[model samples]
Target: MSPTIRSLVIPVTDLAAAKAVYTALLGAPHTDESYYVGYNVDGFEVSLNPSGDTAGPVAFADVDDLDAARESLLAAGATEQSAPRKVAPEARVCVLADGDGNPIGLRGR
Candidate 1:
C-alpha cells in the first residue's frame, strides 16, 4: 500500500514550551498529555515528544498495514530501527532509518 506522510513527531526538551510554540504556530490548542502533546492542523498531526532522545523530527507515514509497510521499506533499502509497537489499543507504529540515516516512522490503525 502507498503510504501518506500525515504525522510528525518532534522531540523536545520541554513539553510545555514546545506546546506553546506549536500552538501559536498552528493556531490551535494542543491536546496536552503527560507523554505527548498533539496538534491537529487541517488533516495532519503534529506531536511533541518529551523523551529527549530523537535527534530531529520524525515524519510518520500513515499506512494501511504496518507489517507490510515495514517489510516494503526494509526491502527498499531502509533499515529497521524498531519493530512494530503498539501505542494505543488499536494503533501500531514502527521506526526505520533511510539510506541517509534519517528516522522515518510508520503508523497504522
Candidate 2:
C-alpha cells in the first residue's frame, strides 16, 4: 500500500519551550500531554516528542496496511528501527531508517 505523509514530529529537550515556539509559529493551540504535544495547522499535523531522538524531525506517513508498508520499505533498502507499537486503541506506529540513517515513521489505524 502507498503511504502519504500526514504528521511531522520534532524531538525536543524542553517540551514547554518547544510547545510555546510551535504554538506561536503555527498560531494554533495544541494538545498538551506528558509525552507529547500536538497541533493541527492547516492540513498538517505537527507534534513535539520528548522521547524522540535528537537527530532530526521525523515525518510520519499514513498507510492502509502497516505491516505491508514496513515490508515494502525494508525491501527497498530501509532498515527497521522499531517494530509496530500501538499508540492508541486502534492506531499503531513504527520507525525505519534509510541507508543514510534518517528516520522515517509509519502510522496505521
**TM-score per model over all chains:** 0.89, 0.90
The digit string of per-residue lDDT tens for model 1 on 1-109 reads 6789999999899888888889889876557887988888898988888986668899999899889888888999999877888988999998999999999899997
> Can you tell me which runs of candidate 1 are displaced by over 4 Å?
none
How many clashes (backbone N, Cα, C below 3 Å) per candidate?
A: 0, 0
Q: Model 1: clashing residue pairs?
A: none
Candidate 2 per-residue lDDT, tens place, 10-101, comes to 98988888878998888755678989888887778999989866478989999998898899999999998888999889889988999999
Segments of candidate 2 deviating more than 4 angstroms: none
